[model samples]
Target chain A: MTTQASSTAIDAEAAGTVPRLSLNRWTFRTTPVQEFLEATTSRGIEAVGLWRQDVEEVGLDALRRRVDDAGLRVSSLCRGGFLTASAEADRAAALDDNRRAIDETAALGAPTLVMVVGGVDRADKDIVGARARVTEAITELAPYAEQRGVSLSLEPMHPMFAADRAVLSTIDQALDIAEASGSSAVGVVVDTYHVWWDPSLERAVQRAAASDRLLAYQVCDWNLPLAAEPLHSRGYMGDGFIDFPAITRMIAATGFTGDIEVEIFNENVWATPAEESARIIAERYQELVLPYA
Target chain B: MTTQASSTAIDAEAAGTVPRLSLNRWTFRTTPVQEFLEATTSRGIEAVGLWRQDVEEVGLDALRRRVDDAGLRVSSLCRGGFLTASAEADRAAALDDNRRAIDETAALGAPTLVMVVGGVDRADKDIVGARARVTEAITELAPYAEQRGVSLSLEPMHPMFAADRAVLSTIDQALDIAEASGSSAVGVVVDTYHVWWDPSLERAVQRAAASDRLLAYQVCDWNLPLAAEPLHSRGYMGDGFIDFPAITRMIAATGFTGDIEVEIFNENVWATPAEESARIIAERYQELVLPYA
Candidate 1:
């Protein structure tokens, strides 16, 4: 599958077409929905990824129409799954919530719904058990997501978050769950910040693309002198140790033509003006991400 | 091989012999060697693990004799390997230092020299290359360690430390290097704080034990709201979210009767008196670790 995509992508690139960037809402999470859209429009960015909370604050339909009117393509929705609860009632509630998230993704016309699989069960630190629960939950939801026309993109968060945030700690691990679902609606995400440290990522990205499961391409640098929270230590494209071009080349090698989403979660970044942040992010994407993408 | 160990350990346990705890120096890093010794001696703690810096500060020979006189056995030396240098001169220097470290371990009568194989190459973010360097360096040093009768135990640090600390981040990764050396002198350290999150740890521990490569067993909990240094956030046994009995059972299943080293690096733990800290750590280990061991 990737062979054709690779050749076609090369042919297209040689013909002068290039991939575009999708600015994730978490990059400027504090900005109001209207102002965030204005910032994207001002930067001439056609693609934007929205978080669940952001759409909720603005009323989903209102924000959806605003994005549609502004000609902004909804590349992906920020989140969905927290299906690791042990109790049947809690687990059922998680599935219900994810169903709504899927509905919202379709409502916003987003192509994908990114899922951060819940961490360990609260009463015990059984990571293996938690992962099993995640797989079970994704399997149950994949068909629903397929019916709703929004692919479920499972994200492998950094291993540091394995204990408290997401038990899915590697792209291969996420792919295992997605492939087990045996549905095209289930896919995997390649977030550079989460996966750059993986020794097997180069080959894993190739496998993901070959399987046609590479649903989203997310980029963010990982910084040193990590924040106390660890979550807020994600840096701007060029501000950290990640070799962007090398990793981007890995994705490109798989013939990925998806949005190269910039998804940073930094406290200092949140303090910047939305418009200025968008402009700077676009510039960084051009210089650091576009050439390879 | 694990089957043999399991049966033998079962027989031994049936005979009433059990594992013991070794208080790591970092568990009382701020205490004077004499005070640390006094605290351990008073508590009837028979084993301790010393850091390179601490040994260097007090003079290696003096400390060795002190441990002897105090009737305390050295379980394993704190660390040795930082052999991830790309340049020949730097790499050669690293080898020299590791040789000295082996000599120090032999001098101290410690059976194992714990190795934190250094991070990615300084000039590039090539973890793959750095990992290769670590293997090559370990291969070169294995014979020398055998001659010195000090087994080189490769420690797989948490993935979060991959960029700036150790390249070995999984027990299987360490075992690959250890087994490749084809020398009994090469082994692996199973530090719960580092390897607890690994999905394959249960199986990997079995492999390590079967190969007779389980040279040291270290314990420490991972706390949330990481310390400024990140490294200093290690909690006492029960303070963090790790399921101790489940993991400790993996080690015991391997029939590992070696010292169960308490290796916490928390700031608060360091602030207490060495005697008080020793008492608390021992208590936690008994409550959280002993039943499984």
Candidate 2:
């Protein structure tokens, strides 16, 4: 329940070993699971956020072994819970998929599973209805996630993604659903790229922290004049206009000492050699994000 | 304070003559003011949202006379405020320009002057500071706008444009500033292109309308997978996935009987001849927007 104003001193670099950056698999999503794992470890990163795609390819158990052997903690699982389907069969299927994601998160020893609750139903303009469905879906999954020791970290994507990706576009909105669920298993992801434009973000962070619902924190720059494939246009830390120090300061004020994942989706960054991408992430994370964290 | 639930019926065809559309000057930004004026009136459109560039070229008096001669109403002025500047001189300069804009809006018989309250200062990531400056700048200009009988319509642009355009990114946030100014002259522009993704839009529209602060409503679909120059990527209705009928229904619930401006910034739409663009806009307006409003 920490709502401390952002600290102005004790820079992460000077403090040392405290505020380590986590790498999400999506950053080097183009690379093989094994190669990516090795690259992250070689850089001495402490934790990673795993997308289901990589785990599926390598098989969950084998992937789990790889993460454990590399001494990397899973900050959160990539995603689960796209509960906005129109069909009876499809809606039921989302629950099953989320159940699997929770099991995998628990299996990987990850405390949280990031949930980018899906977009509205086809031709469905009822975002309210779609959002209601998300709440209902999470309600259904909350118990299962709790049973599996996995928290559903609802990730509010940028509003630009509201149409095609996630209808949840603000931390406070995600927190609203989290609160209504009445379960500790439900939480919110305070991703900088997704929420930097939020005017009430500082207060939202305080609210999340007070409720102890701040689950995972992700970082990346918002590419100015947003890129075409918005899912892929996220810039490395210092490359865009986001005020990392300020945003990270908000998260830090929440007393959230969890992994700050460098979850970028830029095409150009991903197109580069995986190793190079890892290096850039480390540099930016230190220069722009770490000091503030 | 009409807090009635959104109207579920009275489709535009049945309601008729009410909720007339306003053609924004930027839709045909390349065309001469005279040509643009003729194209709009030819379609029997009753109102327009004039851009400053076009109005400047035609000279304020000539454009005002032309609008008057055609019996077309000026829905609102294109823009006035850009107060985000690090230097006091630059900011003072913006205030000077906005005063002139307020005078022009008065001369043109427009009730409101849209203010894209500036973005972050140079190399400054402090969006919070920039947003504060907008409130201050608006407070400074609020009296001038009121004296001229023109409301300062603070437009909350889409978050994508937050870096380089309006720091205000939500209807409620805009209304907060409008309310804080404590003046009838301070109102908000409910531009769908900028605010369609807002989860709080429906409620904010009602709140603004209740406060009698909703001075304008601009319509344009968000180009899915936002375009490069977000400033110009706005799509004609139906070109993107915005649920206009639903959004307009929300606005209508607020009892906002005003011009719905078709303010597309799409390069493709602009590339079309001004007359054809008007034709397309009218078609989309009738089918997508008018039904609900």
Candidate 3:
């Protein structure tokens, strides 16, 4: 299956046609949405993964019209969930926000709403409990997401972010949450930058596929020094240590044909012009992912 | 088994005896070994994990005598292996140095020589190749180490260190090398700080125990950001996000009765007096690890 897809992708590239690629908004956070859309459309890249704040900034109605006019594909919305908080009010607010985010994602025609199941919120230090809370929040939100035709993709951020970002640090853990949610609407996002270091990653990806839980496959490289602050230091594809081809092959083996999204959170890259970064990302995607699509 | 051990530990501690703890040399790199040892002894800690460079500074012979005079136990030796260099000359030099380290570890009666199998030589992007080189290096050195009654403990660093520090980044990966080397002398060192983030860690620890592959069990916490440079910034147990007691319980469940060595590499902790650091580490271990033995 992967070979056939790769051949088709190669044929398309040879014919001077661009293959599918999703630009994660975090990569162009420095640029205004209007400028970003203009740049993306100019480059002939049609798909984008929008962040909630980005949508709010552009006004959802205006953003929707711009996306439609540009013929852009909404791959997946950038976020929802920090749902595992200590305060009941905060947790409830998060769920309400997520429900609205799901509605926004549906309005944008995004197939998936990415969720970062959050970290420990109390002094109790119960990671398992935090994970349980995440599972509960997802269960509560899944029916609404399904009704809105939006899949919820639980992105297990890197273990480095386990404290403040996402306690679900592995695909297996995310899949477990999906299973407990009792909704196929809830699935797992396989991000190379976050999970490439996992010894059981291949098996976990296969498990996600077998369980019909694979929602999104994001790509980026694991840079050295690992960065003192993980929020910003992601390496561009092929520029760091991760073997992108090997990892992408594993994701493909899972029968995951989801958009190969480029989600880099590098301060250096974000500071550059959105068009330049987008072009570089698209070009690298062509070089690294197209051949093995 | 863990419950029984914890009870025994509690009884021992209540009797006003000092806990058996080992100081990892990296924690005191800023201090002279003689001064560090003097401080540790003054504080009532009796065991030390020595670094090869520190041994060189004091002269191995003089160092051995100082340890003996101080009645200090050499728990383990800090390292031996950058065995993945691109050049054969460098690889051979690494092995030769490892051989010297084995001899020194034997002289000091340190039971295990920890190995940080070095990362990919920039010219070689093949992680599999680097791993193979590390395996061959271990195989070559295992017999010599066994003959000297010095076991080789392959310490799989955190995956964040996979690019530049050690290609062996999981306990399972380390166990594979030990199994292939076919030398009981070649085993794994399970460090909670590095492996706690691993979702498969519990299963890995159990497998390590079943295979009698555990050589040393080190304790520390996984701090956020993972430090762009992992040589420093390890969190003290109980101060960070890791479920230390749970991990210790998992290790103890394996029926492995190895010493639980405190191997923190935090800059803030190190800048303080070594005696104070050791006391704090001891206290944390008692609060965290001792609960699970």
Candidate 4:
């Protein structure tokens, strides 16, 4: 027993020697998946947050092989919700696809599968109804996700996206749904760029930690002039006004010891080489986040 | 007593006949104050929201006379805070100016004076401190406002303005300060363009109403392809996807039977004759808010 315990302690120590910081795939969406992986690996990043399209193009087997060969961890999968389909068939298909995504995340050895509960379809003016549908869909999908050994992370996007992207706009709102869903398997992603402006942020973070609903912490900066095309205009970390160290301290206060994922959706960053972006992010993680550790 | 009661009822009915819509002076920043008011009053607008600059240019007394002669209600005076100054002298100056503004609002018979608590001075990184300064300034000036019978409306602007404009970004946050200040004179202005995107909006509105913290309800639209300059790019009602009728219904649910002020700060609207702009907003308000009513 002592020998086994010592071996475990040594393994833990080895693991601690190399810190993990995740690079969200959207940061380099302009690059091919294989190239991105190769570049990121070259920069000594051991973890990645991937998108569905990237996996689809590379094929799951190829992705699995690449991740394994490069000794990389799949922190979280990019997306799988858009659950606001107008038709029953469409909604059913979206759910089925989400289940598949859960399977994929589990297959890739990722713990959390991200969900972006889609906005009201153009013809639908009932935002409340749309939100209800999102909650129901997640409730239904929770069992499947649990069965696959994957946690579902619902991302409440910025309020600007309430009409067309994701109806969930605040962490507290997301937590309400997560609590009502009655599943520890379903949780939420706390993205700084989307929620840094929320006045209830500290309270929400504490609540999320207390509920064990904080599945991931995604980092990015809030640009000075929020772009007309909000999806592509996210600022890179340290480039904009968000208090990152403060957020990290808040997250840590919750006893959350998880991967601090860098998620930028900047057009300028996306257009750059994946390796350069990964290196920049990794360097920032060390400079900004290391002190907290 | 019965005759007086009957007369009051008759006056209320007459006031109710004209839909309560006020043009925020910032909407016509480019136009001369006299021309703006003259055009708006001629277009049958019953109320106007004035700015300090507008009052200053036209001379507050002259503007007051013009409003009286035109039989227009000064729904709200545009602004009075900018209280987040670095130095004691600057802070004192802001408070003194706000006192003058309170006097002006009283002269114009404006029920509310809008307060946009300014952001941190560029060199300062203390937003929380700036907010503290704003609270202190407001507290100092609240007595003057109360004596003059002018309610000080704290306008919590959108989060995009957290750095350069108002630090208060949520209705709940504003209400907390309003309650803390121990002054009924200080309340909040609920602007649709700013607060519509808040996920906890309904609850915030209800809370504000319950506490009698709702001093004003301003209306405008959130346009997609958010204009090049967001500060002045608000859309007119029905032009954007904001659920106006639903929001108005929520506001009414709060038992806030206040003026539905039409405060659109749009470059498109402001560039035109103020009368045309006021007419357009009045028509939109009637079309959108009346249905909800």
Candidate 5:
């Protein structure tokens, strides 16, 4: 599988095409939606991962029309999961917001609604309990997503964000939740930046694939000394310690033909012009990642 | 097991005693070793986990004699594993240093030498390769450690440290490595700050206990907005989002009677006077952790 995919990707690149490349808009958060879409399309990138706030900025209908006009595939909606709210009102608001995110995902024709399960609540030291709440929330959202013909792709974030951003911190845990949701709408993402350090990644990815739950394959490098914001510390592929060939091969081996999205969260990358960032993403993805994926 | 241990701890604390509270020296790295020891003993902390640099400062023999004279139990040595060195000479030197650390652990009458298996090498991007090297190093050191009657405790550091500090990033991975070492001298440390985010932690802790590989239980809280030096970002037990009672119960349920070492690495905590830090450790451990442990 890897051999065939590697050769095909190489052949396509040699023919002057960026194969399987998708630009996740957060990679250039400074760019407005219109320009970001224009930049992505100008570079021949056919797909993008959209964030909820960005969608809201232009309004979902306007953004959907623009994405359609650009002929860009919405790979996956950027978020909709903070399900760890302890207060009844907050929990309701979160779920209601997630429901709206699912509607937006369906409207945008995105197959998956990327979910970052909420971290431990303030005044709640129970991470396990918080994870349980996330699981429950996923169960609740799964049916709605299935009804909308969209999948809820659970993103197990880096454990550094486990306390305050997302308690779901491993592919195994995400897969478990996805399976337990018992709705085919539930799935898991294989984001290199998040799960690259995972020891059982190959096995987890295999399991995710076997279960048909591998929704998105996002690429980014894990950088050091973490940015002052930490969340924006991700580097461009090949610029950091992640062995893209090894990890990408593992994902590619799963026979996953999904868009290979570049979702770097670096402030430096964000500061770069969208076109330049798109060019680098294509270049790095071809050199470091495409051969494997 | 949890009920009995929990009640016993509660009873002990009700009698005005801080049970199972061992002060890990790095908690207050600013204090001189002599004053650190004095402060520890003065606070009625019966055991301590020592750092190699601190021991080297006063010389091993002198520190050993002083600890013995103070009637302090050495729970475990701070560290001895940088097995991710890619060069042959560096690898040999790291093993030799670990052997010396095993000797130091024996000399101090500490049962275990904590091992922080190194992260990716300077020019290497292969984390999986680094982990395999760490496993090989542990296998090689196990017999020598067994000869010295000191266990090599593999500590799975937080994933945040996976890039630059330790590739060993989960309790399950550490336990797997320990088992593969095929020596009783190989064990694992359960450090809350590192593994608290683990969704499989309870099961992993149980596996460690079932295999009799639970060598050390270190307590510290997971603080956010990580300090500039992330290594020093750990907070006092109750100050962060970690649910001490829950995590402590998991350890205590393992029937682990070893010293529950307090190993905070926060700058503010380090700046506090050693006496005050010790007092706070005792107080926090008793309140947030002891009953569960």
Candidate 6:
């Protein structure tokens, strides 16, 4: 793999076309890693956000080589959080796992590790305590991630997912935890699907940018009649209720010149051919997101 | 119905027990209004928050007489704000409907009119604009409500409902709108199921109380594996992940000795006999919430 810091530049063929748009691998959920990379590159897409499973499936080194060969940069790792487990042993195991994720992110040359911090344990009812544990875990992991030259990107998932996916449900809350970590390695992800409904979003985004904690931005739409599988409810830009222009303007205003990852998790989206999905994502990015960005 | 203002004291039998337990009519969703009122009173419930449909179905005067006969005080009215319509005529209609609701609340002797402010219109994608519209509508309605001695209680819904139900999805946003209204008639409702995931809830509650905007308190559990129909996903107090004691403690700390309305919208709870549902609610309130309050 080319040993350069993650680049936001598009490949020669894709140069000058939505350069900051990265096709998140989960958008092609069922595609093989190599094929997804090929499809993304063939569609003039120059970067991607990979999941741990995708790296593990083809072996990390091989995946990294394939990504490099395709002239694509890794935007950010899919996840490395789940640190809200209550048991000490479980919490410790989670931290060890996160450290491993940090190494993988570094090895891939990704600058940030997207973290979907854990929610309340099924057996536990203390969400406040669970959230405190998440803050504590991030504080402990921040230094280790910093030592590896990686940033821990805290993702504030939608409130619907607060019970099982992530306790950090707003950008402000993520910023609070990130600030408390007292390490530059700690930052926040502003994913439109999770935060588009926030009334305080403008202020939160400004605060995140002011503190230099706005590390990555993800785009997707918040569709209605929520999908049967809530986790997979995201839709392509402009296909749902999100006003990408308004939110994108806020991100652009922050001077955030980074990859804007398009991460859709809908089952219908997964059923599309990877090339078709990539093509549509690029076109939608041009019409809906790029103007504001 | 009892002619005096909404009372927090439970009926004689329930007074020494859970004195502030108010049975929200939606907990008996499918039950007839008269029967629901009788079931609530027989369970020693002294107060109730009602849905407009419940009053209209039986005729407002008829329902009022039924509530008075049952020795129940009307705690609050279920709704009165869908003011996010983009069209002038639609918005005007919404305000007119809200005025009617306020009059009904006054006639029923309820002190508060719960407002579920409308979300973005299905045909539109301007959530920011929609939210602004909500603020404006409430500002216009607050004075009308104040003159009638009714407080317009803004119920900030869960973000999942931000698309089809309410655009105001956080207590702080509701407070901002309420405070801006510059009317004592403007206030907020703290529903545990909606605000439980908010990391800033403790501070929000404190602020709401300090400003005397804490008009009502609603309780219901946020159950996992969300129901098939999300609108009907609420469970009884002890049946889900919410920490009632902690949240209740915050309200108590504010000296909010107001009615604690148990408002569950679950299909399963509705399937249970009305009496049985009321019994379980009273039992759970005592076991999980009363101790803290």
lDDT of 5 by residue, A1-293 (tens): 24545677767756766878989988878998889999988877889999988777888888999999999899989899899988889999999999999999999999999998888986878887888888888998889988999999999999899988899998999989998888888989888888989999999999999999998999899888788877877899988888988898898788998898899988788789999999998888878888777
Model 1 chain A scores worst on lDDT over the 10 consecutive residues at A1-10
Q: Assess candidate 6 and give its lDDT.
A: 0.88
Clashing pairs in 2: none
Q: For candidate 6, lDDT tens digit of each residue in B105-174? A: 9989999999999888867788988989998999999989989998999999999999888999999999
Docking class of 6: medium
Query: In model 4, where do residues sit more than 4 Å from their true spots?
Result: A1-18, B1-17, B85-90, B120-126, B273-275
TM (chain A) per model: 0.93, 0.93, 0.94, 0.91, 0.96, 0.94
Q: Would you list the clashing residue pairs of candidate 4?
A: none
TM-score of 5: 0.96
Candidate 1 regions off by >4 Å? A1-18, B1-19
Provide per-model DockQ scores: 0.59, 0.61, 0.46, 0.45, 0.82, 0.74
Q: Which of the two, 3 or 5, has more DockQ? A: 5
Better of 1 and 6 by DockQ: 6
Instruction: Please state the error at residue B242 of candidate 5 in Å.
Output: 0.7
List native contact recovery per candidate, as a fraction of 1.
Answer: 0.53, 0.66, 0.43, 0.40, 0.83, 0.79
Give the TM-score ranking, best first.
5, 6, 2, 1, 3, 4
**TM-score (C-alpha) between model 3 and the true structure:** 0.91
Clashing pairs in 1: none
User: How does residue B43 of candidate 4 score in lDDT?
Assistant: 62
Worst 10 residues of 2 chain A by lDDT: A1-10
TM-score of each: 0.92, 0.92, 0.91, 0.90, 0.96, 0.95
Candidate 4 interface RMSD after superposing interface residues: 2.3
Candidate 3 lDDT tens digits, A58-128: 78888889889988888999799898887789888999999999999999999999998888764776677
Poorest stretch of ten by lDDT in candidate 4 chain B = B1-10
| lDDT ranking, high to low | 5, 6, 1, 2, 3, 4
CA shift at A28, candidate 5, in angstroms? 1.4
